[model samples]
Every structure is written in structure tokens, then in C-alpha cells.
Target chain A: MLLSGDPPRGRILSAMLATIVAVLAVAPFLFPSTRALAVAERIAILIVLTASYDMLLGYTGIVSFAHTMFFGMGAYGVAIALTRFGAGWGQVVIGALAGMLLAIVVAAIVGLLSLRVRAIFFAMITLAVASFAQILASTMRDWTGGEDGLTFEVPKTLTSAFRLGGGYNGNLVTYYLIFTVAAVLFLFLLRVVNSPMGRVLQAIRENEFRAEALGLRTLWYRTLAGAIAAAAASLAGSLLALQLRYTGPDATLSFSLMVDILLIVVIGGMGTLYGAIVGATIMTMAQYYLQPAMGGLANAFSGVPLMQAVLDPDRWLLWLGLLFIAIVYFFPTGIVGRLRTP
Target chain B: MSEVLLELRGVETRVGRYQILHGVDFAARRGRVTMLLGRNGAGKTTTLRTIMGLWRAGAGSITFAGRRIEALGTPEIARLGIAYVPETMGIFSQLTVRENLLLATGRDGLASDRLDRLFALFPALRERYSVPAGVLSGGQKQMLAIGRAIIEPRSLLVVDEPTKGLAPHVIEVLIEVFRRLKQSETTILLVEQNFRMAVSVGDDVAVMDDGRIVHAGSMADLAADEALQHRLLGLSLAVHQ
Candidate 1:
């Protein structure tokens, strides 16, 4: 498959992706309103977040649920840095690194304890650890601002060119900043996934026993992969705090983030990077369009109770739930996997 | 007289507290094909697993090239110049045949020359070099597995059942590959239950019963001693017209 060129399928996909990204990148300049740019910005962040998780779930086959701890930490780190210390872009990046460090430490403890267990047990352990982090964040009311949350000033230096930090600019600057950061991380993920390390990881996922027998350090590789995922999540978290200009227990350590990321990975595909983008786009758009779309459908199907439930704009989540179930049930490989591989 | 490259002294292994290998003493020497013969559940593969450090040696010492390797992990063991071709073939099925070979052939001497020789030995592999090994024939897969082991700077090539489920022609092809490996002065340890083929390429053989070696001697010696062989192998060596 790697060397095959039976058709122009790859070129077609690449062109399609390039066109979509071009439209996304250029839309803010042409649009009268910045809402579409905001959507793109949020979608780009979700792509990084989901792609990071897919590294383990899709490629490495080490499902982790506690990486949200890193994301939350990253969000809190940059939020606190920008609000308290009046930090700049460099400081925000440093704060993001701190979030990554926090993630690494947590992953180490988790990795050490759970390295021996495979599959579901690993997933449960990571989930438990993440929950613990969330609970701790909520308990620290003074630092995290609990459910109500804390306001943060956008870093004056990062907002310098657009004059956004002084509270004067539009969403365009923020979206571009988020887009650039997410793009860097996305490219980084691409590089890492295609590297030698990635090959070993994919090999480990395929057959761990053979990997161990071949002399690869299975535990270390797994831990490293987990750490990379954590780092990626932290970056997304930092961006989340940046975009909102705030952090709270509700926003920083939300379970919704985890659920949405899961949906993104599942809907897109597990093993491939492009799946993150596919998954994220559908997930982000569901919230934006599902309500309006469902409202229109509900008016058309008044007599049907189940269709009412499915099309209730207030219960758009039900539609999402159905789609998710359908995807997992019908296509075990995922959307990208189903479309791409023979 | 052949040089003994490896020696196992009462090697025992356990998987989740259930003992698989209970004190197996075995040896494979230089420039000779040592065949480990046993029934399916007789711990033949387990013995190979322990020797390669896939499973930890609960009790025993395995010395490879005069160095104690029982404590080492499999990768460390492989780095010590021992290559294992497992029963599952250990072919990275998702990767192309060439990628699989490259990963296994890590820094081994005369690599290009060895690769050329291996490709020559298995032309089917060369033809399907870019294809995933998952699609290859069982015999071709077996040949690829052996060829992978041979491409390395091999001190010992421990193969777990190279002839498992191959056609007569495929087995014949594998035997030729094994013969070529022998000519390269590489020591080969084969795990086999196929009586005829096992006896053919094998210089020495160990009959394993219930995780222990019941008999170990030169193949010719066992071929001549019908009564002793029948007692250990539970098979008659005599040909019937």
C-alpha cells in the first residue's frame, strides 16, 4: 500500500485537504464576521487534542484516559501566568512546558504502576488518575476558582501586533495565534509518527510479545508515547486557556473535553493522524449545526416520537450519540480507515 | 568436534505461577544444527522462549558465548548476537518484507552480501520484497523468517518450528535454506516435530519430554540406536517399503 499508485486517490485527497485548509486559512480575511474563523481556530485546537490521543489509541494501542490532567494543568498554567505574572508569549510557552512537565510526572506514576496491565485495565487506570486530578483541581478553589472560574488577561506581548490584549481587537488575532500553534504541534506529530520511534510503537501495538523478544524496551517506549500524548494535550490546554482568557475547574478539567476527544478519535480513525482532523471537524460542527439542523427536522417529524427524540434541538446530543454508536457498530476501523484502506 | 556456543543448566520458567519449563538442561554448539524435538505441549517453544529471555528463567543459567544471559532481556540477548525466529515467525506483518529485514538486520556484518545471499536463497521473498509478509505463503513466510535470522551477525539462530505446516516442496525449500545457513558457519537450533526432516538437517538432536530433555546425542547416533530412539522419541526410525 505504501508504494502502490494504482490510482490518483492520494493526490485527490491531498488536493481536497489543501483546498479545505486554504479556505479555512483565507476565510477570516474575506468574511464580514469572524465567527467562521473562530470555528476554524477551535477546530484546529481540537485536531491537535484528538490527534495526540490517537497516537496511543489508534497507533500504539495504549488507550489512556488521564491525559486530561495534563490539558487541565496546561490551561491553568498559562491562565495563571498571563493573569498573575503578566507573562508574554515566551512565558506562555514556558507555562505550557510546565504543564507538560506536570503531565510527565503524572504519566510516570501511572506508567510505573500500570505498565504490566494491557487493554481495559490500562484505560481504567488512566481514567481514574485523570479523575483524581480533576477532583484535586476543583478542591483548590483559590487557585483554580472552582466552578465559577477565574478571568485572565491575554498576554500583552502576544497580543501586541493586533492590540488585542488591551481589549481592542477582534477574534481574528486569537484565531490565527491558536491556528499557528496547533499547526506546529500537528506538524510535529506528523514527523514523530513517521519516524523510527513511531514504527517501533506501531510494532508494539501489533504484537507486544514479539516486540519484547526482538529486544525493544516495551515499557520505556510505552511511557514515552504516553508522555508525548500528555505533551500534546497540554499544548491544547494552554491554547484553550489562551483562547478563553480564563480558567476554572469547570473549563480546565472538564470531562466534556475527554468525551469530545474520544468522539473525534473514534469518528475519524484510531491509527492514522488525519483521522484527528476528520473527527474534530465533525465533532465541532455537530454543536454549531446540530441544533439548527435538528430543529428543522423536528418540525418535519411531529408525529414520530423517536424522530422527535432524535431531532429535538434541545437534545441534539441524542443525534450525536446515535451517530457515534452507528460509527462504532458499523465500522470498527473508523471513518478515515474505512475510506482509505482497502 | 564442534564448539559449544550455548549451555543451559537446569533452566526453569513460569508463566503466572504455572511452571512451563521444569529444569531443562540443553546446549547448542558452533557450526551445527541442533534440533529440539518434542510433542506440541512438551515445552519445546517454552524452552526456546526462556533461552531468548521472552520469559524469565525462574531457575537456571543460560550461558551464550561464555556470558551468562539468563538474566538478560530478549533484546539484550539479541544484542549479544543471538537471533530468535519464533513459532509465530516474528515477521512484522504490517511492515514490508524489506522493512522487517532491515529492522532485524541491525548493524550485522557484511549486510549487503548477506542480504544478496538470502534473496538468492529465497527468490520468492525478493519478488515480494515490498509486499507485506502477512500476504506471503506459509512456506515463503518460513523461509523469510529463517532468512531474517541469517542476515544478522549471528552467533546462534534459534528457530522454533521452521517446518510447521509447510508443504513437502516448501519444507524442501526451507531445508535448502538451512543447508546454506550451515555452510555460512552459523550455528542453528531448530525446534521441530517432523521426524523425517528433523532427522535430515539436524547434526544433533534433543528429545524433550514434559519440559526436560530425555535424550541428547548426535542425529546419526540416534538414527542407529532404534530401541533407544523408540523409547525417547516414541517413533520408529526404520523406513518401510
Candidate 2:
């Protein structure tokens, strides 16, 4: 029921999903290192963020370059609230709510104003809007802390110093909080994509003209999808801010983050919500470990200058890009798509 | 006499710089099949698009069930009980055959009886119900398109070139399907290049030339007279056969 009757078909894909979920569930205990826990936390947050992006780009066929803008709204909302009102549960709740509300309103306005245009034009509009939001965040030094960004305290319960009995600590609590929320949000997205309304979204995505002829007011549905995606992305941002205890344009509103989300969506699979979990896990782990692995490889190839240079840790991004290209070439429909196909 | 279910008077439509429909006038009588016949580039498709409000009529009025609909948006016009099947067939290729019809139902879920009736009409759809529509053959896709239109009991059905590019037997199947629909008194506006199919299923006929209706009469009169057909369509039903 959580999946709304849409199951992750294929034994390989099902096994992979189960393994990822299981690993994340007990990640802190399995890999107790601070860096490892951090990687796990990042994966959790990215799952929610990428899945929200999938709601727009994959399901609704909306290509928005401003997803990071909504994400930034949430991060900045929490950061500013904590800085101004001081850290508390009440401030966190209020900030997150405000950010989601703003994201929804802005997303709706953008959708209504520009969604009637062709896809490319709408994408450009979102890009411009996102750039403007980034600039606004950077220029507003008084409230936003400017380009320097902001770091603030969370509730005492989430801090590392607060430890429970039997070696349990607030870090574990924070991780669990994020993990639980991500799981709930992920299921929520799955439910939405498999619902009757989600079917209409897919129909519109496939052919807008036919959908309208079917008596569906497509613009309204598109706007609703955009608003909902923004709300979810906003929540994801809030989680990120809570986990890192910091918020900045580069962290939440960066164009690079948007590109990362896009890559994950494509690599995992478009239009498949389950793809988000797979994509985020793979991508985040690679981002954390690939460079180190490349360094090890580079050291092994040190005897050969060309091989060493090619395998240098700094060139991890090049390898990542090549890997992405390979995945796309081999699995054009994406990993999940390839797996789902009979 | 059956009343006009849909009427277009001086409905002019422009696509960017080119005017596709110029003062087009025609009517689809209730409980009858109105065949819109034309050669290529005669604005047959454009007229159908205008009727469905896919294209805004730049001038004149389009009345459906005595309501002026030229100003309405496509969805609003569609909500008024008109189902349009475009020449492209407009099948949502990514969706399963069942999902495609499910979307058209506009309900929470598909009614079993309606689906059963659809399966009876197009048994291939039932066999491939769970398969993506993209993989279906051309004829099956056409059947799916018509099936989607009639999935629910719509008041008027507008279809464009249902027999285009299909084989003889497939065309025969479609003709039979339309005849069955005709017996049910479902008002239909059909566009076709195949005169034989038009002659077999059409009740009222409207012929378009250079973006305007050049002839409007009963299909029997047009079918019975070859000279009139040659003058209007540049070919007779016998020649097409």
C-alpha cells in the first residue's frame, strides 16, 4: 500500500533496493566512523531531494532549473530563523513551514506564468529565476550572512555532545530523524506517482494535447506538480540544514547541486520514483569514495607517469563524468529502466 | 430531422502566419456520422482541431449543443462531452493500454463493465492490456485511439483519418466498428481520405477545399452521383475502391 500497488519489479532491482535500505538503516552501527556516518546522512537527504526533482522532471515532464532555489529557501529559512530567533524546536518547525509555503507559492507563480510556453523556454525561465534567487541570497548580507553563509545551533537533542545511555548519542538521533523523514517522504512520493492523479500527470507528460482533449486541465495539473515538488525539495533542504548545522548558497542553491540532481535522476531512471533511492545512494557514495579510491589507484600506478596522472585523485570528476556517460550509453533508459525491461 | 449537435459558421483559424481554415462552415447532426472529406492541405485536420478548440478560431462562431465554444479552452470544450481522436492517434506511448484508457475515464478507477465492453470491441486491447501502447502495431494503436474516445459514453466523437495508412482488412474492421457506433446513435464527426470507408459509414457529408466547406449534403446523394464526387473530391468512390 505504501507503494500504491507499484512494486519495484525485477529480482536484481529489488535486491539492490533492499540492500541499500538495510545498509542505511544500520549505517552508524556498521560504519561508526564520523566520515562514514556523514556519507550515510548525505545519502538519506539526497534521496528525498532527488526524488522531489523526479516528481517534476520525470513524472510531470517539467524541466525546472530552479529546484535548488526552493531547496535554498528551506535551508535559508532554517538558518535565518536559528540565527535570529535562536535555536529551538519551535523555530525549526516554523522555519520549515514558512520555507515550504514560500516554495509552493513561488513555484505556482512560475508555473502559471511560464508553463504555457514550450519546454525549453520554461526551463530557461526557471534558470533565470534561480539565478536571481541566488544573487538575492548573496547580496542580502544582513539576513543571509552574505557569501560567507551561516552556521547555527540545532536543538540540544540533535547536537553530538548530547549522549543517551548505552553509547547512543544525539548524532544517532539526528541520523534517525533524517532517515525516518526521508523514508516517509520517499513513500509519499511513491504513493503520489502511482495514484490516479499521477496517471494523469504521466498522460500529460506523454502528450499534452491528448491530455487536454481528455478534459484534463493540464496547466493546473502541471502547476500542482511543480508546487508539490517544490514543497518536498524545501523539506529536503531543511533536513540538510539540520544535518550539517550549516546553510549556504553553494550548499543548497548552487547550480552544481541542480546538475547533480539531474544526473542522479537520469542515471537512476526517469519517471521511476524508486530510481531516486538507487541513484542518490550510488552517486553520494561515489562522490565520497571515488576520489580516495582513485588516489589509491594513482599510487599503484606511480611507477608509470602517464597512468599515475590519468588516475590522479583530482581527476575523479573526469572519471565520474566518464562513468556517467558509460551508464547512459549502456543503459539509455537508466539503470532502473534497464532492469525493469523484460 | 436530427438536430445539429455541432455547428461551425465562418470559423477562421490561423496557425502563425498562415490561415489554415478560412470561413469554414459545417455541422454534425445528432445521432449521425458526419464525414469531413478533403484532399491533402484542404484544412480537414485544421477544421477538426478548431472544433476541438486545439486551435483558437480567429473569426466566427463554433456552437456545440447550442453553446458557443469558439472562445472556450480545449479542456473546457472537451468537458462538454466531445471526445477528439487526432490524426496522430495521440496514444500515450509510455502508458500501458489499460492506463491509457484509465486516464480518459476521468474517474478514480476504470469501471469493469465499461472495460469489458471496450475489450469486446477491441479484443487485441484486452490481450495487450498491460503492455505499453508504444509497442502496439499501427492498426492496434488506431483501435486503441478510438477505444479511448468511446471508453465512456461521450455525446459527440470527432475522429481524424481513422483509416489512414491502415490495411484493407483493418479498414474493414474500423468501418464495421463505426457502423456499430452509428446504430447506437453516437454523433460522430470523421475526417477521411478513403472514399470507400467514408461512403460505407458516413451519414452526412461535408467536403473541404482550400480551407472552406465546398459541399454539404447527405452521403447517399454524394455516393450515388459520381460526377459530383469527382468534381468535389477529384475522385469517385468507385475510383477509390
Candidate 3:
């Protein structure tokens, strides 16, 4: 019912998703360490971020590099609001709203101007816009904190100093808050893709010409998709800001983060909201754990020079790349797609 | 004669440097099937695209239901009770047959009576209602394309090469489907290469050559005179049959 009639279809897929959600729900108790909590929080945030990107890339069949720019907008909105107006619930609300508004405006403008062009061209235009946003964030120094980024305090209730009774601290409360928001946003996205409007978006994705001939204004729908995706990304960014209490071009506006989002969507499966959850969890876990696991493996192989070198932690990225290639080769439709096929 | 429901007057369309439809003038009467027949590169597809506003007319006018629609967008033109099925079939292979039909309707849900009529015409669509359209055979895809066009009531239906690459039996079925549509009083403008299928369903005919309408008259006249058919189409329809 929460999926709005579009259920995750396969037995394996349903179990995998359920396991991931269950683990995240009890993550604070199951993994208690700060690093573990951080990884879980990142997974929650990335699920929202990647699912939002899927709205454009998977569902709408449009590639946009400017997703991070909107995300950075959200981060900076919260960062700047807390920095200028001071930390409070009201400030968080104002900053999040401002960020979403800005993202929607920019997304509308970019979509209207560039969506009429061919796909590759629109992608290039977004890439250029994203690069420009990055440069602007770096140069704005005073307000944006330039390349160094902005670090500020969250509301007292969300900070680590505020401790509830029963061994629960503010950090735990914050994690749950992020987790809850992510779940709601993800469900909202699922509902959207299942709706009649979502059907039109997929129709446009499959065949724009046919969709137009069918009397749907494809440009209007595409722009709406972009704006909705942007707003969602902004909210995700705001969540990231709340968790880290920091905003930076490197963290939110980096091109690498954009690439990470793309890889997550592909690994989970394109065009399915459930893919976002699966993809983001796998991708974020790998980012946090792969290096440490590789380090331990290298230590165990210390007796063999060649084996140790190959298992070096610094080469985690290479291994990650190889893993991605293997996934693509084996499950060309992506994990969810392959699971659903049979 | 039924009043003209759709008309193209001296419509000119240029695709880059090449002029595809040069002063194409034709009309589809209310409740009649107007077959636009031509050789390869005779601009039959271009004429259909122009009528649907997919391609803008460089110099001319398109009037549908007594309104100038040459300047309108494709969505606007379609919203005016005109449905177009391109030569590609445009089936949206990623979506299920039910979703494909649902997209064609203006309302939230498909009308059961209209859906029953569609299922009656193309039972394969009913059987594969929930399956993705990409799995359907060529003939079934063509059937889905036509079924999508008539999912809702429209004053005019424009389709390009519905029988292309279809089996002989499939063509017979399509001919029957067109006859049923004709009985329902839906105007159809069909661009077809199969002379047999054209003559079977077409009530009116327009012959295009070199981006122009070389001949226009009743389908009976074109079918009755082998000499005129040879003169315009460079072949006799009877010989093809």
C-alpha cells in the first residue's frame, strides 16, 4: 500500500529490500559506533538523493549533471541560514524552504532552455551549469565559505550534547530523524512513479514523439520531472547538512558525487524507485567499508608481497571499478532489473 | 457527401534542404477512409506528419474541424480529436499494453465499453494486457499501435503503413478492423504501400508523386481504371493482387 500499488516484484528483491530497511531501522542499536552511524546516515541520505536523480535519469530518460548543484543549494541554504540567522528549528525550516525554492527556479529555467535540444546536448548544458555552480560556490568565499566550506551548529536537540534518558543521545535522535525523512521522501517518490503522471513520464521516456502524438505535452512533463527531482535533491542536501553540520562544495557540489549517484542508480536498476534504495545502500556501504576491509585483507596477506600489494586499501577504488564492470556485465539490466525479469 | 473533417491546402514542408511535401492538398471526409498512396519518397509520410503538426508547414494551411491548425503544436493538434500512428508503430515497448492504451485516453481510466471494443478487435492485446509491449510480434505490435489510436473516440485517425511487414493473414485482419472502424463513422487517413489492403478499406484515394498530389478521386475510380493507376502509381493494383 505504501508503494502506491507498485510493489517490488521478485522474492529475492523483496527480501533484500526488507533486510536493508530492517537493518537501517535498528542501525543505532545494531551498530552503535559513530562511524557505523555515519555510514547508515549516508545510506539514508543517498537513497533520497539517488531516487531523486532516478526521477530524471531513469523515469524521465534525461541525464542531468546539475543535480549536485541543486543539492549544494540546499546545503548552502541551511549552512548560510544557520550561520547568518543562528541555529534553531525556525532557521532550519526557513533554510530548507529557501533552498528548495531556488533549486526549483533554476531547474525550471535550465529545463525550459535546454530540454528542447537533443539528449546529449542537454546533458552537456547541465554539466556546464554544474561546473559554473561549483566555481561560484568556491569564489563566493564570504557567504559560502569558499572551497573551505561552512560548518555550523544544528538545533540543540539535534546536537550530541543533548542527551535523552535511556542511553539515547542527540546523535541517535538525529539519525532517526534523517531516516524517517528519507523513508517518507522515498515513499512519496514511489507514489509519484505509480501515479498517472508517472505513467506519462515513463511514456515520454520510452518514446517522446509518440507521447507527444498521444496529446501529452512532453516538454511540460519533462520540466516538471526536472523540478521535482531538483526539489527532492535539495531536501536530501538539507538532511546532509543537518547530519554533518557542514556545507562544502567538495561534499555536496563535487562532480564525483554526481558520478556516485549515477553508479548507484545503474547498480540498483534504472526506472524503479526500489532500485534507488538498493543501489544507494550498496554504494554507500562500499564507500565506507570497502577500504577498511581491504586494509584488513592486506594485513592478513602481509606474508606475501604481491598479494598484500594487490589487496592494498589505497586501491579500493580500482576494485570498486572492477566490481561495477562485473555487475554491468553479469546483470546488464541492473540488480533489480535482473531479479524482476524472471 | 459527408462534410470535410480535415483538409490540407497547398501545404509545403521542407526537411532541411529537401522539400518533402510540396503543396500537398488533400481532404478526409467525415466517416470515410482516405488512402494516401505513393511510391518510395513520394512524401506520403511527410504529408501525414504535416497534418499532425509534427513537422511545421513552411508555406500553406492545415484546417481540422474548420480551424486553422498549421501553427499549432503536435499536442494541441492531437488534443483536437486527431490521433496519429507513425510508421515506426511508436508502441512504447517499455510499458505494458494496458499502460499504452491508458496513455492514449484523455481521462483517468479507460471506458469499459471502449476497452471491450478494443479487446474484440485485438484479442492479443487483451491476452498480453499486463505484459510489456516489446515482447509482442510484429503483427501484434501493429495491432497495438492501431488499437492505441482508437482507444478513445476521435474525429480523425492518421496512420502510416499499418500493414507494412505484416503477414497476409494479419493484413486481412487489419482490413477487417478498418471496416469495423469505418462502420463506427471514424474518419481515417491512411498511408499505405499495399495496394490490395488500400483498395480493400479505402473509400477515397489520393496518389502522391514527387512530393505532390498527382491524382485525387474516389477509390472506386482508381480501382476501376487500370490505365489511370498505371499512369499515377506506375503499376496496376489488380496485378499486385
> Tens digit of lDDT per residue, candidate 3, span B51-135?
8888889998999999999999999999999999999998999888888898998556899999999999998889999999999
Better candidate by DockQ, 2 or 3 = 2
Instruction: Return the TM-score for candidate 3, rounded to 2 decimals.
Output: 0.98
Query: B22, model 1: CA deviation in Å?
Result: 3.0
Model 1 ranges off by over 4 Å: A1-16, A30-32, A157-170, A298-310, B105-111, B238-241
Worst 10 residues of 3 chain A by lDDT: A333-342
Q: What's model 1's lDDT at B180?
A: 73
Tell me which residue pairs clash in candidate 3: none
Query: What does candidate 3's lDDT look like per residue over A116-183, in tens digits?
Result: 99999999999999999999999999999999999999999997789987787899989999999999
| Model 2 lDDT tens row, B14-132 | 99999999899988999999999988999999998998889899999999999999999999999999999999999999889988898888877788888888888788899999999
Clashes of 1: 2
Candidate 3 runs further than 4 Å off: none
Model 1, range A256-311, lDDT digits (tens) per residue? 77888888898887887877877788788787778899899998998898988767
| Candidate 3 chain B minimal-lDDT segment of 10 residues | B99-108
Rate residue A317 of model 1 by lDDT: 79
iRMS of candidate 1, one decimal? 2.7
For model 1, residues B1-241, the per-residue Cα lDDT tens digits are 8788999999998889688888999889898999998777888999998888888999989999999999887778987878889987888787767767766654313367877888899989889988888898888888777777777677888999888888989988887777777787779889987777777788999889988998898988887787876788777677510
Docking class of 1: medium
C-alpha lDDT (0 to 100) for residue A281 of candidate 3: 89
lDDT of 2 by residue, A60-119 (tens): 899999999999998888888888999899999999999999999999999999999999
